[model samples]
Structure formats: structure tokens, C-alpha cells
Target: MRTQTTPPAAPPVRATGRPGRALPLAAVLLAVFVVPMSISGTAVALPGIGADTQAGLAPLQWVVNAFNVAFACFTLVWGSVADIVGRVRAFAAGAAVYAVASAASALATDVLWLDGARALAGIGGAAIFSCGAAIIATAFDGPARARAFALFGTVAGVGVALGPSLAGLLVQGLGWRWVFAVHAAALLLVLLAVPAVAGAVPADGGSGARLDLPGSALFVVAMVLLTTAIVQGSQWGWVSPGVLGLFAAALAVLAVFAVVEDRREHPMLDLSVLRDRRFVGLCLVPVAASFGFVTLLSHLPSYLTAAAGRDTAAAGLIMLLLTAPVLICPMLAAKLVTRGIPALTLIHVSLGCLVVGDLALTLFSPDVKILAVALPMLVTGAGMGLSAGLVDGQALELIDPAKAGMAAGFLNTLRLGSEAIAVAVYGSALATALGTRVDNGIGDHAGASHADLVAARAAGGDLARAAELSGAVDTEGFVRFLARSYDSAFHTVLWGLAAVCAVLCAVIAVLLRGGSGRNSRPAPAGNSPGDRGV
Candidate 1:
């Protein structure tokens, strides 16, 4: 009998040169954008949603933070699962889940239900987000990959920039539910496209690898405790024993996680990656970007509505000027990179723009025109667009192809972690400053007649009220003092952000070490091994 011989399976074909791959890639990019857009867009609609549902401040905060916390915690797990289960299937599952959750959110009767739905959306978001770049990495190479990433980055930037504006429109026209309903529609589009793009890439064979469940558990505990402490410290009092206890627990859990990961095979995160200077820089770039980005996003609306005295709709519109360039800049940067501009140079320039933007806002006065505020915001958005993809691309470039999933997970984890910290810290700072100004103003009027104090208190100690009491007990000086105090507090926060941005820019510039000019050559092409993963 003739010996039967079976041909060995051919290597998995890359989609880089496939016809119409760009269309699917665009769909994938859209899916990624939906996650961030959903979160940011809902922010402007929060007050309206709360009022409609009769939710309190705590619940309102959860409506936003629940998604963020879940997304941050599960990012690595989802990435690892994608590597084991197959990227296409994992991504498709995420889309389906996200769509379901979004639909449920629209019908939610209570704040708790809405928050639960949002948390579910975050789980699905993690699955899609973790695998997004990996799909792009596998499907494109060289200059094509660079451009694809640029497009992807641009889409993300636009989604973020447009989120509040979209929310404003939706709330004005149909109500807040449409903000979520729209995502459900978008998720359906992604679901239909996944099969066409993924082709025959088999499920990953690493499912049997140890998952480091203990380490993951410990990490979750630590992150939760730490984030809660930071977020609640201002409201609860920083020195409160409860806050201190949570911090202590966070440290303990962190220590345990480190110990467990050190001993585990197939650690959820390969700590060894941190030793690479390039990787460290790449990770920090995004962290810094998130710090600056969240600070602006969280506080800008408040500034517009409260200090600038704009209505919700107008405030949302003004905020768009800051975000619009975020969408546009990535495409421009992609073109620049195709011409051989170094990623590091792009990052430095972006950081510089952030510094400049923050500084402008710090110096802004009540007399400043809306255009002046809008201009700085545009600059900031442009900077974010240029920097976002450059860091992701650079980070992937520094890692092995097999480790791309893990590396991406780590980067995302750091990004979200930075954002959480930024929101908590900056929110605390702004609240503290506002409180201090109000308290000082009240104390200065202590010698005023009982009637004046009663009147001031009833008016919420507003600046205008303080001015009204000017004659009650030599109150003109008190009014000027309070006005100056408010101005100082406002500038202090703005200038603080600017200073932070400046420091980040200086560090990145030194580490990146390149001039701003674009290179003339495109990235190398073909089935080049060096171009495989990043």
C-alpha cells in the first residue's frame, strides 16, 4: 500500500494585500470609536438624565464611573481571552453584548439599572478595544499599517471630540436615551463586518496557558480600593479613617499581586516588558496624554457652564472646539508618518500643544471672547490627535509579535488608570478651590449685622450676594477680596494643568530626541518580518 502523506497546513495567510480589506478595517475602527464616544457623549447629558430619573449625585457619578472602572479592570483579561479564543469571535461577541446592553440602557427605569447596563457595555468594550489594534496589526504592514493606524486614531479622536456635541444634539432632539440607542445601531454594523475581515485565522492555541487568576483578583481589589479612595477623599475628608483604611488595603493587595505574578507561569502581565526603555516611554506617553485629556474633558464643561455662564447646549458646543481637531489631526499625522516622519517627533509636538493650550486657558479672563477659549481648545485637540496613534504604534513596534496582545493590554490598562487618577485628582482640586474661596468670603463678613449674614447665607454666598451686602458693614473690600480669591483659584487650577503639561512635554522631547521635519521615505513594504506585529 502506498504511504498516505498529508500536506502540512499552510501558514495563516495575512490580509495585508487582500482586496477590500480597508473597508473591514474601517468598520473595526468604528467599533473602537464607539466605546469612548459612548462614555464621553453621555457626560453632557448626565444632568438631564439624572433629573429625569430622579437620581442623586452618587448615582450620577456611578453612571459614568461604573463603565470606566469595569473597562479598566477587564482590559487585560479580554485581550488575553481574545488571544486564546480568536480575535474575530471575541470581537463579534463584544459587539453583540454591547448592542444588547445599549438597548437595555435605553429602557432602564432606574439609575441602578442604567448603571448596570453601562457596566455591561464596558465589559463588551474591553473585548473589542483589546483586540482592535491586533486585528490592524495582523492585516497591514509598513506604510499601509502606519496609515491604517492613523485612520484608526483619527476616528477615535473624532469620536471623543464629537461625543459631547452628539450628546447635546440627541438630548435636545430626542432625549438622553438616544445617546445610547445610537451605539446599538453602530454595533450592528460591526457585527456584520467581522466575518468578512477575519478570514480563516484559527482560534489561538494558548487557552491552556495558566491565567494567573490570583494575580488578576488581587489587581482588581487594589485598583478598586485605590480609585475609590481617590474619588471619595474630598467628599468624605481625606484624613477619614475609612479613606486611610482603603488606601492601606490597596497597598496590601498590590503587594500580593506583585508576589503572585512573580511566581506565575504565563503571567497576565509580563512585567519584563517594563525593563525596556522604549516600551516605558511608549506607555508613559499615553498616560500623560490621558492625564491632560481627562483633566480638560472633566472640568471644561463646568467652567463653561458655571464660570462662563453658558447654558448646557451652548457649553457643549463651545467644548466642541477643543475636540474637533482631535479627529482631524490623526489623519494629518498619518500622512506625515507615511512621508517618514518619526513617531517620537509627533508625540513631542502634541505634548507641546497641550502645554500651550492649558496655559492659554489659565490666563483667560471673564472679558476673554469665546473665540479665545475655542482657539486653545483647538490646539489641544490637534495635539491629542497627533500623539495618540504615535504612542500605540511605537509601543507595538518595541514588542515581539507573539506578545502583542499582552503588550496592548498593559498599555490600555495604564491609559485607563491614568484617566481615573486624573479625573479624581483634578475634580478634587477644583472642588477644593471653589470651597476655599466661598468659605473665606463668608468668614470675611463675620462682623456684618445678623440680617446681612442671614441674607448672604440664604443666597448661597454667591459673589453677587456678597456685593449686595457691601454697605451692610464696609462690604466693598470684602467683595473685592472674594472676587480676587475666585479668580486666583480658577487660574491656579488652569496654570497647574499647564505646568504639568509642560513637564510632560519636556520629558517626552528629551526621550524622543528628534526634530519636527518629516522623512522622505515610506515604511518598508512586503512580507517583512520586522513589520509583522506593531
Candidate 2:
């Protein structure tokens, strides 16, 4: 009996429609690499940046928050802009903006300057993700598109998975400034290769729709206000008037946005996509990952150092157990789908891994070894790895190719948006939980606010800062108290994340049930996915 194996996925064609098909994938991959790196990598550099600039915590926090805010808000706007201007043009413009902003970040003299530059980079990153995914969606079809998106997913996942480790290396060896400098260099290469990608697609890829100014403005304001409120809620006090006001303002703007979109001749967003229950449901895959995986990805290092009793290097290494699966799973998921596994089945499995793995991760404690938590970490990573590219590719297909940019933008908006929300929620919860524990241990005192600072610093793994803020007679005991308090908080948040992920997974399973309920797709004009899109 002969063994049967699935044939390899088809390769993406060049813009010139000839031999050498890797340019589009390579260029877009390079451009997108920096965006996620910036997202996950900057946290490692924050302390170094703060120390050098002597900036306070609030200003320092903006380095990451500002990037997230701009990235989340501008994706939809950039999606529309990409469709109007052409994907390659839009990608190049975004790369240019990112390059300049990164260069400015490398040269910044103060925290405020760095924050502004990082925000600018986020704006550029918004274009990179929305337009880059749109381009992939347009440039290939069938097996080839799956392969292209699989690689796309893998690169992004790996970028995020390894960002801190790589960024830490850079910060340690060459200083924090060099991290941004490296981003600037990588984006410049992407810019130079844009012509190759441009040639791979149709010149008239745009929908020729006039820009929707009112809708766009409203969306930016709404996302900015909403994400800002969430990011600052922990620091500013969640129930404070300012946070409440921002939430209210965001809601009002969104209400107006809905009305405006309903009335517009050409809305910025395509409402039909939103109305598609399947698309909306599938979009939450990333949202779930944000809570179950990314919250850990960005914050786990702190936990390992401060709570798990690991050193920085050991924490970074152990992180490999969680991130290693992402490197392999995108391709595995694609291969499975190509070989006839139902994508929905795989998604269900992935979500299960995230929730189940997170619950299992309750085993992680100060005395726990890597071998103890390894299985759960791998399971959680597999969950994220399976869905990262698969969900986006499947979700994008549900919409018309002409609206690929919008679809891509909206999908990622939920993705990156949920990431901001998840991280903020997780961080806030951990801080609050830790603060309460510390307050109980220390008892009532005039320096009540100082406990909050110590909790924040300790949870962030800044023991020096936490200690300095503590002003304790016995520093070692205080550190132990901080660690124990943080450990308790870590366990508490894990339970919450697991519960949230399980709920989301169940919801998504229902949404994606009955398989791809998407209307039958027409044959590609040139037998390519993004021909019309380009």
C-alpha cells in the first residue's frame, strides 16, 4: 500500500505574473514584523528609557499606551485610505511614516518626544497591518492564499512571541535607543522593495469611493477615547470622573458614527460585513488571544521575575515554552486546513487550548519548575498559533474582495483593540489585587497611596522602584511581601482570564458553527484572490 500525503501549498505569484513569487510575501512580512515587535518589545525597554530620561511612571507608560491607542484607532481609517489610494501605495506610505517615526524615537530627548514618536509609529503600524493583510488577501487565491497567509501569521506571531527576548538583547547590548533604530532600518528595506509588490497586483485595485470624513473622524475619536480610558483606568482610578467621562464620550461618538454610517452615501466602514454574524464572531479569536495569551505574553515576564522567583534571563527562556508553539502552529493549521480538516474544528480546538491551558497554568507558583507548567504553556501557545493567521484568512473571505482593506482593518481593529483592552484589564486587575493584599499586610497608614505605587512597581518586576516606593525599614522582608502579594494576584487573574476565554470560545464556536456560511464565491477574474482588490 502506498502512503498518500497532501501536496504542498501553491506559492504566491509575483506582481509581474512570472517566476520568482516571494517578493510580495517577503516585503509585507518585513514591514509588518516591526509593528508587533514594537507592541511587545517596548515593555522591555521602558525601564531603561525611564532611567535615562528620569521620566515619571505616567509619562513612561505612554510610550506603550500611545502606540497602542494610535494603532487601534487608525487601522479602520487606514483600511479605507488603502482602498482609495491603492494597497502598495498605502503600504509604502505607512512604511515611510513608520521609518521616520522610529528614527525620531531613536533620537528623542525626552519621554514626551518618545511617546509622540511612538504614537506616530502606531499610526504607520495601523497602515502596515490593515494594508498588508489586504494585499495578501488580494494577491493570492485558494491553496496559495492559504500558504501566504500562513506565513503571514507565523511572522506576526513570531514577532510578538520573540519581541521581548530580542528587544531585551538589543537594550542590554546596544542600549534602548538602538531598538527603535533597528525598526527604522528594517522598514527602510521594506520601502525599497515596494515596487516588486506593486507589480504583483492590479493598478486599479481601489473601489474609487470618496473618503468618508465624518465617519472616519467619529471612529478615530471613539477608539481613541475608549482605548485611552481603558489604558488609564487603572492609574487614574476606574470610577474617577475622567475615566467615566471618556467612556461616555466614546459611546456618544460611536452612536453618532452609527447614525452617520447609516446615512452616508459611501460609508468608511462597510456595514454589510458587520451585519455578517460569522465575520463578527470570527473576529473575536484575536480578542480571546489578547486576554488568554497576550496578557501573559506581555505581563508574564513580570510574574516570572517578581512572583515565580525567576531571574530575568530565566524568565525570558521559560517564555519559550509558551511562544515556541506559535512558530510552528500557523503552518500546521494551514496544512491541516489544506488537507481537509475543517477550519472551524481547528478553531474550536485552539480556543479550547487557550482556556484549558490557562486554567491548567494555575500550577505556576513561586516553587513550580518549568517542567510543571510546560504542558499548559505549550497548549496555550498552540491555541494562539492555530488561530492567528487562520481566523484572519477565513474571516477576510466572508467579505467582498473590493472591501478587503476594510475587512482586514476591522478584523485587526478588534484584534489590536482587544489586546489593549485585555492588557489594561489584566494589569489593572493584578495591580488592584496586589494592592489589596499589600494594604492588608501593611495595615492602615497615611501612605495609603504608596501601597498602590509599590504594587504597580512590583507587578511590573521593578523591585528597585517598588522598594524605593515602599520606604521600608527592612527592604528584604518588604520585597518578600511584594512577591507574595503579586503571586496571589497572578493566580487570581489567571482564573479570570480562563473564565473569560472559555466564554469567548463558546460564543465563537456558535458564531462559526455550520461551517463557512459565506455566500458562494465567484471564480477569480484572473484566478487570483486580490486581483479585483488590487
Candidate 3:
């Protein structure tokens, strides 16, 4: 016993997970950053692409549209697929796919090739977002989980905020192709860290459940039809047979998908998730953002440049005030929660900001050069920022960890779907308002009314084009008239959007109430409340 007791060393304890979390966290955050950046990054390079590829507006638009449409349709699909395979595996596969597509985009010689590559990239982006959120959910817990998601939202918001400027710099310095080339390189680096990421994530290996191919296909089809209808409704006319048919088809497919999921032994989506009022309310937080925040992100710059008489640089700078909160508010909300501020309370405050901010935005005086909209812009941006990840983090906490990917996917689907719907609604409503007010006196002009053509052009902020399209002899007077019409239309739409947000805010409040006072907290995951299909 006395010999410096070299007692048998305890059997080596096998490590159950990676020794550290930093690598995996960094890897996932990098991938998440890349996807949203890609969504917004390529727009700045569009002019350069057109010049190089000899493409017209129709083809050029597809460069952006293909990505958005594909991304919107595939997120839910990828979410379901992630659970079927493994989150890490699906995430790695998506990164690989994204890298390849991005590289292909760089090497493309024509708009068609670029569009195809971008569409492929969108598919990969869907996987990355759905799986990435799930990975965070699995790898982190408690306060760490909340903080990790806060970073997740911050990075995504930063990507969206910086994409245009960063791409513009690259385009000016290197060329448009480098924009995608850089993404390819970055993703490749992310791929290199896959081993570390895999180790950190507990192996939630596949349950050997076969995918619901029929349900997946029908869901994809439904998303396609709905998104396509919204995207094209303005061009085709909302009441046109083509648009109406697409809307009807989407509803029918969705109904079929519901029926299929209801009957399937292993369905892709747990339909009950939709039935959970609190979860549905959580998902709609992003929808509020769609009308109150995203619509401004897309259209506000045009108002500043065309109506406020700001230069592009000035408008871009002003837009920063709107996006800045997105970079900071996520963490602030998370911190508040840690300090015992109920997450639901913060969410309600955020919704109030959106409504108040949208109403305050109407203070813009068409004749004043001052941006009276600054405080309102900040308030609106703060609304978006506070909920960016709070909604997601809370929603995931409510779901079984095994189903986190699906929950993430559904959340993103609503987030993106709302954006598409909101922007389309805003665009069409503005154009229609402008059209109604534009000098209806030109109804006799060649073919359809010049007023209609000019209103559309003006709505697009192509004043020169609008003036030419109007065939007005006094181009200056016509341009002024067009600007005034746009200002009036924009103000009118702001009021309408504010009203819509107020109504939605009330609806969301009721849903969040869930028949219990302000307590919006969901039950723990083991006793998960939503669709338990798979």
C-alpha cells in the first residue's frame, strides 16, 4: 500500500462531445451569415452583370427572383430532410452544395447560367438556414442557447445590412464574379470545419424514417404557386385569370398536402404545429416585420432618393439608420430576458414599436428636405432587431429537440413568405394608387393609357423612363407630376400598412394569449404540443 500507490488509473473517460463549442458555433454562424448575404449581396452587381452578359431586365430580374423563389420553397423541404438524415450531415451537404453553386455562378458566361447557379444556391441556402438553427438548438442549452441564437440573429441581420455595400465594393474593385467567388471561398472554409461541427453536435442520427415524398412534393408545389402568384400578380394583374388560377392552385395543393400529412404514417410536416396558437403567433412575429420592416428595406430607399431628393449615397447612408438596430437589438433582447424580463413582454413591446414607428413615418413632409423619419426609422429597426432571434429562440425552446429543424424551417418559411407577400402587396398597392391618380387625361395615348405606363415606371423610380413613356412635351413638368403622385401614393400606402400592422398586432396578441393571460411561454419539449407526426 505504501509504494507511492500507483493505483490503477481510472479508465479513460470517453468524450461524449467535442471538447469545445467555439468551432462549431463559429462554423454555423459563418454559414448563416453567407446565406442571407447572398440573398441581398448580388443586387448591387446586377448592372455589371447585365453589361457583361448582355441580358435585359427580364433576365436580370431572374438572377434575384430565382434565388428568392427557390429559397422560399425549399426551406421547409430541407428542414424535414435534415431531421430524416442528420442535422450536421444535412448542413454539411448544404454547405457543399452552396459552395459549388456559388463557384458555378462565378464561372457563368451568361444570365441563364448565372440564374441556374443562383437557383441552386438558393436550395443550398434553405438547407443551411433550417439546419443551422437546429444545430444551435442542439449544441447549446439554457442561457447559452439564448445567447447563441442572439448571435445568430445578429449575424444574419448584419449580412443583410452589409451585403449590398460589400458587394458594391467588390464589384467596383474586382468585378461582379468575385462577389460569388468570395462566397465560394468562404463556404469552402466553412466546409473545412465540418469535422469539428459534427463532433460538437450530439449524433441525433437518423431514425431510419423514410421521407414523405408525396407530402414534400405537394408542399413545394404549393409554395411555388403562392410565391409565383405574388411575384407575378403585379405584372399580370391581380384579377387576371393566370394570377387567380395560380392562387387557387396553391390553395388546392395546400389542402391536398394537409390531407396527405394527416394520413401519412411518417409525414414531412407535423400539421399540428400550425394549430398551436402560440407557435403560430411566434411565426407571425416575422410577418409583422414583413409589413413594418422588410417593406421599408425594399422600398424606402426609392422614396428617399426619388421623393426626398437624396442622392444614392445619401439614401444608402440614411438606410443605415434603419438597419443599425438590427445589428444590436437581438443581444439587447436576450440580455433583457436573462434579467427576468419575460420574453413575451419584450415581444409585445417590439410589436408596439413597429406599429408606432409605421404611424410616425407618415410625418414626412414632401416639401421639407429634413428627414423627420429618423426617429421613426430607428424605432422600426429596433422592432425588427428585438425579435430577430427572440422569436426563433423561443419557438425552438417549445419544440422537441428532434423536431427543431422542422420548426426552424416553418419559422423561416413564414419569415420569408411574409416578406414576399408584404413587398408584393406594397408594390402593387403603390402602383395602383399612383395609377389612379396619374393624369387620367392621357387615356387616349397610344395603346393603353400613357398614364398607366408612366405610373408603373414612376413607381419603379425610373423618372426618366416615366417621362419618356408619357411622351409629354414638357418633360420637366411631367417628371414633377410623377414625383408628386409617387409621394402621395407612398404616404397613402404607409397609412394602409400601419393599419394592417395594427390589426395583425392585435391578432398576434390574441394568439399569444392562448386563453391564458399574458403568459406566452410554451410547454417543455418532452411534452411538446405541436404536430407530433414523425
lDDT of 2 by residue, 473-522 (tens): 77777777777788888999999999999899889888877665321232
10 residues in a row with least lDDT, candidate 2: 1-10
Please provide, for model 3 over 331-401, each residue's C-alpha lDDT reduced to its tens digit, 9 standing for 90 to 100: 99877766667788888999999999999988875566446778999999998999998888888766666
State the displacement of the C-alpha of residue 370, model 1, in Å, after optimal TM-score superposition.
4.1
For each candidate, what TM-score against the reference? 0.84, 0.91, 0.91
**lDDT of each structure?**
0.70, 0.84, 0.84
Task: Give the TM-score comparing model 2 with the true structure, all chains together.
Answer: 0.91
RMSD (Cα, Å) for all candidates, in order, is 6.8, 6.9, 9.0
Alpha-carbon shift of residue 79 in model 3 (angstroms): 0.8
Compute the lDDT of residue 426 as modeled in candidate 3: 98
> What alpha-carbon RMSD in Å does predicted model 1 have with respect to the real structure?
6.8
* Clash totals in order: 0, 4, 0
